[model samples]
Target: MSNSDPVLLIETVRPDDGRTESFWVALVITGVLLLGGLGILLRQEQTSATDTRPQLDLLQRQFLMELTIAADEIRFITTMNSEVSTDTGFVNWPLEQLLQEQLLPVFPGQSAKAWQQLEPGCLLLPQPASRIHFGLVLQQAGSSIHYAPADVPLPDHCETLLSWQRMDIQS
Candidate 1:
C-alpha cells in the first residue's frame, strides 16, 4: 500500500444454533406451567361463587319473612305526618313496612314531636319501621298485595299496609 492509503478490516458474523433447541424447550415448559396455573385459579373462583349462592338464597328468604311480619303490624299518621281528621284515624299498616328495615336504617324520617293515636289498626303492635310523612295505603291477604285508598271502607278480609311514592319535584 502507498503512504496514506486506506486500510479496511472485515469480520464474518455467525449465528449460534446449537443451543436453540434448549431455548425452545424452556419456553414450552414455561407456557404449560402458566396455563396450568391459570386453569387452577379459574376453578377456585368458580367454586367460591357456587358456595355463596346458597347463602344468598337463605338471606333472601329470611328478609322476606321479616318484611311480611313488619307489614302485618304497623301504625300510621301523626299530627306532623297527617291531619287529625277521620281519614287520619283510619290510616294504618302501610305497605312500606315490607321494606323498612331492609331499605332505610332510619326508617322513620320524622320528628318525635308528631302525634300518634293510641289506637292501632287490627294488628296492634308498635310500628316496626320508620314513620312516613305521607305514604300510599296498601292491603295484604296471605300472599296477595294491593293498593288501598285513603279511606278503606271495606270488610277486614285483607291485611292493611302502607307504602310511599316519591313526589315529583319540579326543578
Candidate 2:
C-alpha cells in the first residue's frame, strides 16, 4: 500500500505566439495616431488665426477709405447746406449698401451692417463667431487719417465708423 502512493503536479503553460509584442505594437501605433492628430489640430488653429489677420487688414483699409470719403462728403455737404436754407435730400441715404458692393469680393462671408437703423454714420465689423465685433474707427487726425479699433479703451485719436448702439449690449 505504501508503494502504491504517488505524487502528481499540474503546471500552467503559456504559448509563445508574440501576443505581448503585438499588444505593445498596437499601443504604440494608437499613441502615435493620437499625437499626430493633436498636432494637426494645433497647426490648423494656428493657420486659421494667422489667416484672419490679412482679412482684418484688408477690412481696415477699406473701412478707413470709406470713412475718409464720408467725412469729405459730409463736410462738403455741410458747407453747401450752410449756404442754403433747405434740407438737401442727399444726406439721408444709408451708405452701407454701396460700400458693401465694393468690399464683398475682397472679403467673403461677411455682410456690412449699419451701426444703427436710423443713423448711417458707422458700421460694426463682421467677424467669426469666436471673435468680438470690432468697430472700424476712422478719423481725421491733423494731416493724417487715423484708423483704429473702436473697442479699444483709447483709440489713438480716431472716431468710430459705426456707432455702439447696434452691438450686443452684453459684449
Candidate 3:
C-alpha cells in the first residue's frame, strides 16, 4: 500500500435509537410536573391565608364567652348578697373591678381599657386579638358578640350596635 493512498476503511452509520426524542419527552414531562407542583403550592398558600378569618372569628367568640361567663358569675354573686343594696347603676360591674377581684381571667396582650356600659342594660368590651377587632356585648336577656372594623369606632350607644355584624356564638 502507498503511504499517501486514500484509505478505504468502511464506516458504518448507526441507526437512530430515538434517544433524542426520549430526552425531549422526559424534559417536557419534568417541566410540566415542576409547574404543576408550583401551582399546587401557591393554591395551598392562598387557602391557608384565607383560612385565618374563620380562625380569628373563633378566637373572638372564645374571648366573648370568657367575658360573658365572668360577668354572669359576678352578677350572680352580687345578687346572692342580700345585705348589699341592689343599685341599678352598679348592676353592670366594671371590667377593672372584675379583674381586681380575680373574677375575670386576663388573656395575653389584653388592653387596659375599661368596658363600656352603653346603656342601663347594655355593656360592651373590646377584644385584644391583633388580627381582628371585635366587641363583646352583654344585655339583660342574652349576650351577643360583634365584629367591628378597624376604621370604624366602637358603638358608643346601643342604637349603633345594630350597625355591627353579630357573630354566631355556640352555647
Provide the TM-score for each candidate, comma-separated. 0.22, 0.27, 0.43
Scored by lDDT, model 1 comes in at 0.35
* Candidate 3 lDDT tens digits, 48-155: 434323435565567657766765665567566532324543346555565567665434666445455576545555654553445544443345556665566777
lDDT of 3 at 2: 96
TM-score of 2: 0.27
Please, what are the lDDT tens digits per residue for candidate 1 over residues 131-157? 122222222222211222334332232
Which regions of candidate 2 deviate over 4 angstroms? 1-56, 83-113, 116-171
Give residue 121's error in model 1 in angstroms: 24
| Whole-model lDDT per candidate | 0.35, 0.42, 0.59
- C-alpha RMSD (angstroms) for model 1: 16.0
Report, for all candidates in order, the number of backbone clashes: 12, 3, 0
Sort every candidate by TM-score, greatest first: 3, 2, 1
lDDT of 2: 0.42
Error of 2 at 102 (Å): 14
